[model samples]
Target: MKPFTDGDFIKTVIIQAATRWFPGEDNRRDFMNIVQNTRLSPATITRKVNVMADHVHEQLNIDLKKCVRFSIHLDESTDKTDTAQLVVMIRFVLENGSVQEELLELIPLTRKTTGLDVYLSKKNSILAHEVPLEKLVAVTTDDAPSMTGKITGFSGQCLRDPDFPRFLSFHCIITPRSILWENFKYKNRV
Candidate 1:
């Protein structure tokens, strides 16, 4: 039997499954097992997935620019390699009443988290490539003092000036799990 190599079909199935199933970290290995059992080389499957992701990103970029109102969600996480990275995700409502979210960029934090200036500079540089700073409607982030300070400083310096455009910034409070559970229980009882 010849090796079954249909990149497009495999890619479509993988993408659909990933999007629909919402597979967690452990489920990913099971997903890979299924793919491997298909008689397709792992490399071929990997390449196909990369191609699909690239295509999705290209379409998303075009769609995002045409959107008038959108929201920016910024979060930071540690990758498997133990590198601290900032992930910028954009949420937009299309003209057809459909909501679309795309991962805009992942920026590695080179310096220590204490260095607000360095982090701000890197964030600005990364964001400038995706969308104009002036066009941002609102920014959502956690209640980190450094992050809040940077946003205030940046907005004041760049957007508040007479020559620049003004934008809105919203901070979302993130608390510990115990506090969150208590709040959730209180809200439920109310």
Candidate 2:
């Protein structure tokens, strides 16, 4: 029997269901069992998903061209496969005063994830998307050593760049407000 690999609706449905429930498994049998036998081979589903991702990525690049200013939040963490992945998210203000936040990319660190590694990955992503560096206003990252180390960290490299905009680099504080208050009180004797 031939696969029902026609129409945009089927592709959309497959993409939605795959993203919703599959999470990790992209097995044809798993999808067929749960998604009512769409008869799509694993290869077809993978191709459709890749095309959709490319479309979204292109749309984001276009939207970025409309931004008056943008800030990026980056976090690096080890995935289930023990690979270091950098999650880059962008928050930008459009010319019409509307704000938007989006996941720019998830980059895998194939080698040592040093400050240079993180910085290069982010720089490549921004350059590939053709986002103007002058429009970048800030960056936020967790207080990891590779992120906060002024002399050797990602922010340091950006700061050293002459063409790069003078952007604020802030450490994102994720602790509870109550705990922070207690710490402040103890430190300041207030």
Candidate 3:
């Protein structure tokens, strides 16, 4: 049998590892078996997986630019590593009568996770890096006060002047009527 080259073995191991992480049955034994079968070094396999992710991200960036209007969904959650991270996802209708979603970014909000100003600044930076501000039609997020404030700040900053883009916010969990009623009640009490 011909000896498998280092690159070939690394690619095979990466594919196997990626399959385990992808949506499927959590067969730990099978995964471990595959890891043992591959002759490549673990570091090599890790690097290959990183490279594959980067390639996919580059391709998605090219495809997103062709979208006419796109909706962004932002949410933050703690990962298994206990790291507070912001996940920004984009949804758009393609030209071929299909809807597509891309995981635009996973930003580690290290210092900004606890502070309103820092969080908003980090969120704004994430938006600037992922999608063009002009292409965003709507943003959807949860009903967290900090998140709502950040969305408001983003709208104001982006639509500050006549030349800037006008983007709207859609709080998925809050109705406009309820918000108005709450505000009215608060004003009457004051």
Candidate 4:
């Protein structure tokens, strides 16, 4: 057989496998060794993955541009490495009024993470996607102290920005209780 050179099939399988959450690296290596029989190197795989991600980024940005009004959801946390990572997602109403949410970015903080820093960084990233600032309708974030602090949180920082739209800000409602858990026992009727 003349080297499997079908980009379409390769892309398809990569997409399929990527969507799955399991299987350790060794398993993938073994499978590739047997089936692919000397296929793309790790660098090549990385390049292909980057290509796919770039295509998705472009497509998502285009969709955001078309949306008249959109909502944003943000989450920030420190990974095991102690790097602060921020996840950004957007929800928009499609032409048929069906809502869709797409993850936009995962920004890693190199230094101290503050409410103003996140606000500015997120604003730059969202605007870079060509989404009009005025069209922002909502901003949802977890009730982390840095996200909703009365004076120094992300929401407050955004509210103070003259360019940021007057959007509804909400905290993620993963449970009935607040993030500080003040309402946890009360909600459980304990």
Q: Pick the candidate with the highest lDDT.
A: 2
After superposition, candidate 2 runs with Cα above 4 Å error: 1-39, 175-190
Best-performing candidate as measured by TM-score? 2
Ranking by lDDT: 2, 4, 3, 1
- The lDDT of each candidate is 0.62, 0.83, 0.65, 0.77
Model 4, residue 147: distance off in Å is 0.7
Give the distance in Å from residue 90's predicted Cα in candidate 2 to where it truly belongs. 0.5
Clashes of 1: 0
lDDT of 3 by residue, 23-78 (tens): 55566556756766765655765677789988997778767766667787767667
The per-prediction tally of clashing pairs is 0, 0, 0, 0
Error in Å for residue 34 of model 1: 17
Residue-wise C-alpha lDDT for candidate 4, range 21-61, written one tens digit per residue: 33677766666555455356556666788899899988887
lDDT of 1 by residue, 52-89 (tens): 98898778767876676676766655689877776677
What TM-score fits each model?
A: 0.58, 0.70, 0.58, 0.69
Clashing pairs in 3: none
For model 2, give the 10-residue run with minimal summed lDDT. Answer: 1-10
Worst 10 residues of 4 by lDDT: 1-10
Which portions of model 3 miss their true places by more than 4 Å?
Answer: 1-39, 80-82, 114-130, 150-164, 174-190
Candidate 2 clash figure, as a count: 0
